[model samples]
Target: MAKAVSDSAQMIARMAPVLDSQDYCFCHVADDHKFHAASVLATFREEEGLTLVLPLAQAQAAGLAGPAFRRITLQVHSALEGVGLTAAVAGALAEGGIACNVVAAFYHDHIFVPSAQARDALSILQRLSAAARR
Candidate 1:
């Protein structure tokens, strides 16, 4: 298994955020649809309904719509218990006036930025990483 990084500085220095080419959106799962877990990127159950992060195309095909977002995957395998990485990334993006939604899985942290601001978000992250290496 790949080693996980717990050092905040190392995690920031090696984040290697890569933007996904496809667009995605968050939408409520259809009331009557039974979605296969593997088909969607992520899901969260809430009091209202299931919220799904789905490819923009898939969501549009299913007649669901929301603001488009681009996923930036931090390639660093940050340990689950690690601190500051998310805060640093979010703080950087926030300083650039970009809102960020983060999803922390076992392996990597994913940052979702507005589709229109994806490149800007990626640049901010790259600079953050470069600064950490300096």
Candidate 2:
């Protein structure tokens, strides 16, 4: 029998743990802008806006978004519950006094937190995963 989406171990494992040592920037450009072609780097876009992840220094030099945003990547299965998953992770981080901004894609969820709080946010996620397993 095919595995149910909720019970698939492989799906759960797809939530890869990303280290929180890097700083990233979220950029927003005009919908018709072709900035991607202007650079060789990969950029992520959605119906609402575009987000680019670059080194903090580079982002600053490029004069992108504000300096307050921190970038984090979370490996989550496409089949996982959206609000529930985000809420859980956010709740955990909130308990630790961390702020977060989350973006969900077709295959994974990305989180942005204060650069200084990345480690704590990551540890909160690790604890969430461990708690879920039990």
Candidate 3:
């Protein structure tokens, strides 16, 4: 059985904002469609074709190129319907003309946005949350 999300907006409310102010260097890692490769965090020789986040500090320390992506952490108590959440958020961002990448963990959902647009995305999410509350 799956626990249903009663309020989509409320779920977004509980999410913590991850501010991104620097560029993060991210690679495709051999086009395998997997980001879990051991070398994903390593092997940074140049910055071509890499997705840069923001700040670039944290990513650099980890041997990752930067600015770092702005991330939002949503703690979904129930099993997340990736399609639903992604569609909702992606729609919101798309409306704002912002690009997003989503990653799911065991207990939470994470949204990654371009560093420059993080604040705007947060505002949009906040609005979505408030709307859900209604």
Candidate 4:
């Protein structure tokens, strides 16, 4: 397993932005439409149905509404038990009037924001990183 970073400053400094071209969405997988593709980004089972984050094209092909989200991946590896990293990131984005939905994987932190605001979100994050390094 990759080492999880706990230092907030280090995490911020290393938050290289990675943008996915395909728009993503969270939708309930229909009974006839199970997401078995390896490319499916993530999934969670819920009482209503299977919630999934998959490519916008795939979701459209599956007849789901477009989620129209841009994914920004933080390159830093953050520990699941790490403190304040999420709070800091979220706070920065919030202060910029950007809504962020974050998913913490074992190796990295993924943030989903509105596609229209993606570029501005990146700028906000970059500034946050720069400020942290000061």
Alpha-carbon lDDT of model 1? 0.94
Point to the candidate with the largest TM-score: 1
Question: In terms of lDDT, which candidate is strongest?
Answer: 1
Query: How well is each residue in 2-38 modelled by candidate 3, as lDDT tens digits?
Result: 3545455545544544444434455433333334344
**Structure candidate 1, residue pairs in collision:** none
What is every candidate's alpha-carbon RMSD to the true fold?
1.4, 4.5, 6.4, 1.9
Runs in model 3 deviating more than 4 A are: 1-24, 29-55, 61-67, 81-83
For every model shown, what is its TM-score relative to the native structure?
0.94, 0.68, 0.61, 0.89
User: Lowest summed lDDT over 10 consecutive residues: which window, candidate 1?
Assistant: 30-39
Ranking by lDDT: 1, 4, 2, 3
> Compared with the true structure, what per-residue lDDT tens digits does model 2 show for residues 1-134?
23324433443334455865656666666567554353412376778777665666665776675655555666655454534667676877889999887777656677888888887877777767766666
List pairs with backbone clashes in candidate 4: none
Candidate 1 wrong stretches, greater than 4 Å: 30-32
